[model samples]
Target chain A: MNNSSDPKKYKNSFLNWIEFRLPIVSYIEREYKDYPMPKNCNYFWSFGAMATILLVVLIVTGIFLAMNYTPHTDLAFNSVERIMRDVNYGWLLRYLHSNGAAFFFIVVYIHIMRGMYYGSYKYPRELNWILGVFIFLLMMATAFLGYTLPWGQMSYWGATVITNLFSAIPVIGEGLKTWILGDYTVGNATLNRFFALHYVLPFVIFGVVALHVAAVHVHGSNNPSGIDIKSKNDTVNFFPYMIIKDTLAICVFGFIIAAVVFFGPNLMAEVDNYIPANPMVTPSHIVANWYLAPFYAILRAVPDKLGGVALMFASILILFFLPWLDRVKIRSCNYRPIFKWFMMLFFVNFFVLGYVGMKPAEGIYLLVARMGLIYYFVFLLLITPFIGRIEKTKKLPLSISNILNNNHSEQNKFQKEVN
Target chain B: MRFIFTILFCFTFCFSIFAASETKNAPKHEWSFTGLNGTFDKSAIQRGYKVYREVCAGCHSMNLLYYRDLIDIGFTNDEIKAIASEYTVIDGPNDEGEMFERPAKSFDRFVSPYLNEQEARYSNNGSYPPDLSVITKAKINGPDYIYNLLLGYVDPPEDFELGDGMYYNKWKEGEQIAMAQPLDEGYVDYDDGTENSLEQLAEDVTTFLVWSAEPELEERKSLGIKVLLFFVVAGLFVFIAKNRLWKSVN
Candidate 1:
């Protein structure tokens, strides 16, 4: 009905005819090419685009891999080896899918951190954050299932250990575990279901990712300064400017992933995964893939099995409450110095917990993990809720354009003084 | 103040806990295929294959590998055919619908020493031999572990006792292994006239095993370099395009 984006505005007859019916041409132009974005968003903002690209890479590679993969526990390991050895460029596809999982998490984690730092989770964008959390959860489930498809010792035992975590429940625990595995133990039924779910969950993640982008587009992008875009002058069209920047970022990310896939393909893979699944011979060390390490640390930190499982679930669920938790007058950590320091400590603690998780849970590692687990909860529950009340805050520029202008003028003044 | 003190306490607690650990670390081996310029030593791999054929093949299986795969490290087609024919593999039979044995082809995978798990376990004193197809990947520090496991056999230290079928190998955790020392000095003669010492045999076999696990290592590395170069060039162009587009705005 709107004449502003009228199909007739375009001289091309075919596009106009198609646009008249579907309006997809105008829809893309408005939503993507002409979408207004804060001009001051930095490289960190590019990670969202990077993550989306990685998701696409994962899906494309995963599909090709599935074509060659056999889901049966007996043949799964051999099939993967066949892919690596015999199938044409199957090695590349397999490496991309596996390493893509890691890279996806890397970019997503950075993107989440970026959001938190700039208060992208605040106010109207809370739904966007919630959708992101959902996507992340789906991704985790998909990755766990994908890992089981290899039918290696780690895959079998990892499934056994994780699914058995359900048995920590009070009454129906054993029933639930059996129900999930489709058998008493992690065997053929478990692998088959996992394979089925693994194939399906990515589409769910894709749907959630679509909702996430839509929600982000509705709210517009949060910039580095966390100042709202006050005028058209404060923003740029998303087409050339943001697209090019995202392209550059994606290229750099692709380079890193390519290096890992080709040169150091096994850099992130556990060596034990190369062996076929032997239910009789339990590996001395059964560690989850690296991305799940921090939560795995939390799970292991508690002595009781149920308590550990509860805490691990709660750890992720707590993120849903983050928007309300760190309630402050100011949005960005750029203005909240104390909160910024705490955030840095929180990130460092996460990394430490991840490291400790990978190490065999013995004396020192356990102690460190326990301490880190405590700090993680403390930061989420206690510190975040209280820090805003006591923290000293810096003055923020009134708008996005004002901040950039101020910085530019200041730089000019410094240059002039030097001259 | 309480937070700082808690952190300090945790640090000390961790330090004290770790200090008590005394797990012996595996000694690193300086191997040919280690760094960026690394490539498999072809002669060593050939010798290692001989070692595998002569000694290790009796127990350990390499079911993933075909006789033709040896051509990558340099084996003549005739040699491969001869190797394949030496082992008779069980196959299905003619119009009678029964099973029979026949000589293998170049593409047939290595035959297992035992027909199945029960047979394997029974023959090896109830301990099944692990497959060597991806042994160099299945274990941690795989090449090093294999090398050390081969040469690690020694007289049991004072106060240490071994059970039947177990040999003392310092390289393995618990300092014991099931398989007795299979190699001695001048164990298998190398056609290339290399020394057949235990260490030499171990090193050569480890190299071969690494290749067996990952035959495309060379292709992967070379392709990685080219892809990286492509990305760099593309990235530079994107960077320029981005800067140029943003020049007027920023």
Candidate 2:
């Protein structure tokens, strides 16, 4: 064995450890050192940090839930109830787990929109954008699977409908469906598999998230100007500056989550989920968890199952091509005249579709959903590319500093006029 | 100012009307199973427990419940301890220095198969055993649904044909149930010398399962009342705080 306190050897080991750890923190600080962030990057930027905190909260709460959760079909629903009623602080645990999911989606949506408004998907940062899309997809899958573990009517029937969608394939439709089900239908077999996948997928998402942050670190965050941050003078360190802002945002978000948990624990959950699953009867409305409602609406908007599934997928996948499809040189809608209005209309259209999705798919609601679905596709595929090229844009300030300088000049002129 | 006030008044009136109408028009489905009403039946729960132990326990597991839970569910201590002793053992810091794994203790719950993911799935034709603790709540239909499903399975009509690998049962409308109802008359010889009928066994097990699902239903309902009281107090405090804080500003 080596001597316990050889100075040279000790020095070498210390150096090795530092060499491994130093680059990560220093690299983050070094790369972001002069990277100009928007002075106007308000509470929106906090969503990303809030999303990060929510993810951590979810993983921790999920672990505790897993400890008490019985994954068997006969026992899974009962185990959840047991957690709520029997286990020590089981109610709090269940409340935290369920509400944490809602908060996670809320923060993530805001985070993604923050990226959208600021053109965070533009060149060099495209990988980060794609990773985010991937994360969103994984999150959706995880949530869907997690929801099914309860084997409630919604969980069972929802899985049945979703897994059966694989049967839409032309040749191997039935076979594929059977393969996915691992049985004749969405029974114990399906529930068991979903449980396994639900547990496994989150860790996979965590891996992808690691890559996402790494990519974001590599390219750096895109500000509202969409200009290269390296070219500007006003910049701050990620640790103290961004960290502090993120912490404050997290506190506010925590307040919101606490309020939901304390006052209205089941506000976001459906009442039907309180019951056990029976395949013989279906619920009146088979809606997914709230995070998935937007896409579910798009799916229902189409008349054909295959077509609806395709459209629903395209709705999300369309976001992946945004960096390239958007031809406009400018990033933010704040400066884009015509594009700004279109973006607002598109947001409202999507919300309308969400509303229509929750309603029975018939009569006026169907018509509304169809119309909203058309706009949903048009906004992404046609309008995004078309507007990017055709819209006449105003000349943007060379940098954030230039915008500030112009504002100062304009203020001085107003004072002179007043005098 | 009058026009603005009138518009606000109209909007509030319309909103309230809409809300009231929506609530009234909300769909009400048949919620009761077996058309039975009142508090849960303890006898039914006891029967359900029997059905679970004899039938479902062979394949499915409820690893969350301890032997002691039976006592809470209306079983005698002697009966529970007897059942527990048959299944598990206790060994710790006794006169003997050696560690021993013996029959389960009265406090011990059912143990799941100690199979890992790969092993569990492989043994069950690519399906893992799910824990039963929360299955009732996880499903969309409540206990009635589970009960209906359990009793739904029957032999298919003579003209009906099931596809390959599909098992036909008359109880299910689709003519297939993954699980064959394990409860049959006289399947288990009751320890307490009670005559065990299939229907009686099924009802008992279902009740037991429901109890296991929500052991603290009574506690939760009472706690809900307490929480509502707290909210009432908090609301009043908030009202006072708002008045005090905004008094000078107004």
Candidate 3:
């Protein structure tokens, strides 16, 4: 794959010199340009590229925001206001970063769901899925910290509430919470530390993302047919085909983000966030942002603080065990009718959890949240492991091309008949 | 088609669920700064500033705003200077090493009525009047909520026991609030010959507060439309390109 001997191989003299020295050109060629992706990958496979684009957008916008942002408790609120009002296009940058975080989650969540639905987490791809889970955790942490940088009512209270979750543990729980906050209460120290960590964590995510992509490249991609590649015909190069599909996906994703930033800028933001931090007054509702709402519902489901916190952490940590939990040979839900229904039900349950999260923890919401919590655990823990044993899977195609070619010929015949 | 229907169903369901979950029942109002084509009514903002000066300024402080911000609402620099001069604010120690008070300047933030939160609370029972700079954005449907509250001084139900120093507002959370009704018919004389009724005063000030809460609203919306137009035009070409690229494979 290395073409260092020939100056004519590269696009120009500068690239040729650089390629001779570093071989980065050949590295990219080996990994991306010449990388073999399953030909049958649908639009779902584009989520990873979309998520990566959003990450870059977030980091770029975040840098501009940090330039204008003052992270101190007293100055943070007004600093943000100044950015919005005085700085040229500060509102746009701030809105993009803030809304970018939300959309990043949307894309990443779909990425995870795609992995799950197609068994991308199974067998050789286990490390890839595990690394992705870690990235998700880091993203949640980064987002929660970023939310606190505004230093508004939600920022202050969310900091207080989430940090206090550590105090639910026995013995050192109180001390651990204090250590995390750098104070007995959520104050200047907490804000300073959060601002620092929020800035630092994204680069950490970038490093882990490198590993995740490496892992993916190592084993290649899992296709819809859930069959491993048998020969060159089962795969296509990443250069023109997959890259073009990703470009279109990125364009569509960018359109969505622009629509939000320009039209309903505060659609994902909290109303109370407009108010500066007032520690004396607690807002009536201290809900997390929509991205974290389902987990927040999990946290509030059990009445006991310790129990709720345990269940919440476990809900996320359970993902690490997912590969082993669903030990079935078959991967794609498309071939598993029962598993497809389960996946659909799981999504519906997630929506229910999100709905119940924003509401006050009383009356019917409590009961519904509890039920959602039970189902979330049962599906991931019980049903996933057991369903494959009893359920009859539809016959899988012989190769990735088998089903697609048949479908194409059938469509052509139908067209001819209509003509 | 099923996919499109599912997406629409999800959006509608999510909005309705979230909307119903919000307990606040603030009546909706048509605002000059709402909708796709909406822009700030400059005259209404000016009138609202007048109402704020005469009524709301006694308790609330717009600590985030400078007198210079008035220029956006059609106030001349000379007029803002005149308005700013009427208020006095504290400045730091000079070479003589002493703090001193001086007439406000164009760059100075609107002066607070009290020195600190404790003083602000002491002057108005124990509840400090919150700053009005972001009042509209701080509450759900901020402008509408404020407008409805200003117009929301309905009598309490017979069974309701009113808290001391609290006035009943039909729209305010818990049906009670600390600040008394601050506006009435002919509360202020409008310089532009606009009628000075209670409703008129509320509307003007609500418009002003909305501007303060989101000064970039007009710019954001207009830029959004341009971006959306670009998306449509550029999207068509990209869509065609995508189709052409994938045609051979299918």
Candidate 1 clashes between residue pairs 3 or more apart in a chain or in different chains: none
- TM-score, ranked from best to worst: 3, 1, 2
Worst 10 residues of 2 chain B by lDDT: B29-38
lDDT of 2 by residue, A1-419 (tens): 45443333224676545545454444544655444355535557767666766777778878888899988878987788677766787887778788888778866876776687667787888888999999999999889888898777788888888888888878899899999888988878888888889888888988888888778777567676666654434345564455555555554455556655654465567656765787777887787675677788888878899999888888899888888887777887877888888776786676567666666788998899898988878877788888866788877777765665677799999999999
Residue A42, candidate 3: alpha-carbon lDDT? 82
How do the residues B1-250 of candidate 3 rate in per-residue lDDT, one tens digit apiece?
4423543565565566646755555568888788887899899999999999988999999999999999988889999999999999889798899999999999999988888989998989899899999898877767888999999998899999999999998888888999999999998999999999999999999999999988889989989889888877777787788788778776
Output per-candidate TM-scores for chain A, rounded to 2 decimals.
0.97, 0.91, 0.97
The number of the candidate with the highest lDDT is 3
DockQ of 1: 0.46
What are the TM values for chain B, all candidates? 0.87, 0.61, 0.94
Report residue A178 deviation for candidate 2 (angstroms): 1.2
Off by over 4 Å in 2: A1-17, A20-25, A28-36, A230-232, A405-419, B1-22, B25-250
Q: Which model scores highest in TM-score? A: 3
lDDT of 1 by residue, A1-419 (tens): 67556548578988887888898888899989999989988878888888888899899999999999999988999999999988988888899999899888877887888888888998878899999988988888898999899999899999998999999999999999999999999999999999999998998999899999988999799988887889999999999888998898788778867867887677678777998999989988889787888889999999999999999999999999898997785778899889898887898798788778878889999999999999999999999999877888999888888888998999999999999
- Give Cα distance to truth, residue A176, candidate 2, Å: 1.4
Q: Model 2, A106: alpha-carbon shift in Å? A: 1.6
- Candidate 2 or 1, higher DockQ: 1
TM-score of 2: 0.64
